[model samples]
Target: MLSLYRAGYSPWHRLAAGPKALLLIVIVLGVSLLPVSWPGPAVAAAIAVGCYAVPGIGLRELRRQLVAVRWAIGVTAAGQLVFLGPGPAAANTTRVGAALVISALLALTTPVGALLDALERGLKPLDHLGVDRQRVALLLIVTITMLPVLARLAHDVREAQRARGAPPGLRHFAMPFLVVALKHADALGDALTARGVR
Candidate 1:
């Protein structure tokens, strides 16, 4: 299976996945809630981008992450710029971009297995509510784990389009991307069923 877990001996890598995930969420949320026109999120975005300096993560990973979300950032900034003006555009774009970067950063520092374990642990108590906690955890963790995979697929699809000299458009991009995504989903479903994850 394709996994994003980078093997690292850094302290960041050693931190417990649950707490690290929580802290990242809190930071992103906190940044997002900053008042309109505030410069805080811009600063947060810069720091979040620089956080690629985490021991095992380097400029290459940072570049890949930024590239992965460039379209999202661009569209967000453009919309905000058009409607809300430059201040909100800067604030919102930074908030959103930093949130994604932090998410990718967590994937870089923690193993997908660890995230699954943490989710399982956190969701166990919900078993009494008649929820299939195992499947819930698996679903949540798998979605989180697929971020990098989706990013890679998008990159590959773009490269394939370029190689074929197909002009880039949302329809052309979405067609192939959705088809490839569904194929991956089918394979993942088969694997999970084989492993009794269903």
Candidate 2:
């Protein structure tokens, strides 16, 4: 999604990153606050699809991107169904799904560098309050970049476990994955300290 956002040339791509970030936040909040109904979420979903359908973001690539998050989307949808009992459950689920789709579209259409730059500038006001805006911005960038890395590591670990005939279950996978992640975190910290990033 991050790659797709940075890959294409379009009106969305041309918009200033700060405005784009603000727009995303506003849309997400507006969607969240809307009464449980079909129209609002349906419209949001339509807009999300439209954003992806713009020139240069072919439907094929959109499908590919969505496929990558299929598991997460499925989990979220299932959780909503199970927890948001009866009545407005369907509407709630749909709204949650639409919000996910909208967020994915934003990431798919916005570069990571642009997001970081915008975040840095946007958070500048906090400097007056001694908020360490630069450090906060760096942390945001690191967190964003770590998502894909952690995902890839998890994928690799899953493949390795499968190769060893381990069944697919959190009980079988959780401990090892956590240990590996902790090791990676330690190594990352060491590297950052070496580079005087702290």
Which candidate leads in lDDT? Answer: 1
* Lowest summed lDDT window (length 10), candidate 2: 1-10
Candidate 1 achieves a global lDDT of: 0.81
lDDT of 2 by residue, 75-128 (tens): 766777788765466666556655655555556667766776888899989989
lDDT of each: 0.81, 0.68
Q: Whose TM-score is greatest here? A: 1
Model 1 backbone overlap count: 0
11, model 2: CA deviation in Å?
3.3
Q: How do the residues 94-168 of candidate 1 rate in per-residue lDDT, one tens digit apiece?
A: 888887887776777888788878888888899899998778878887887787788888889989999999998
Clashing pairs in 1: none
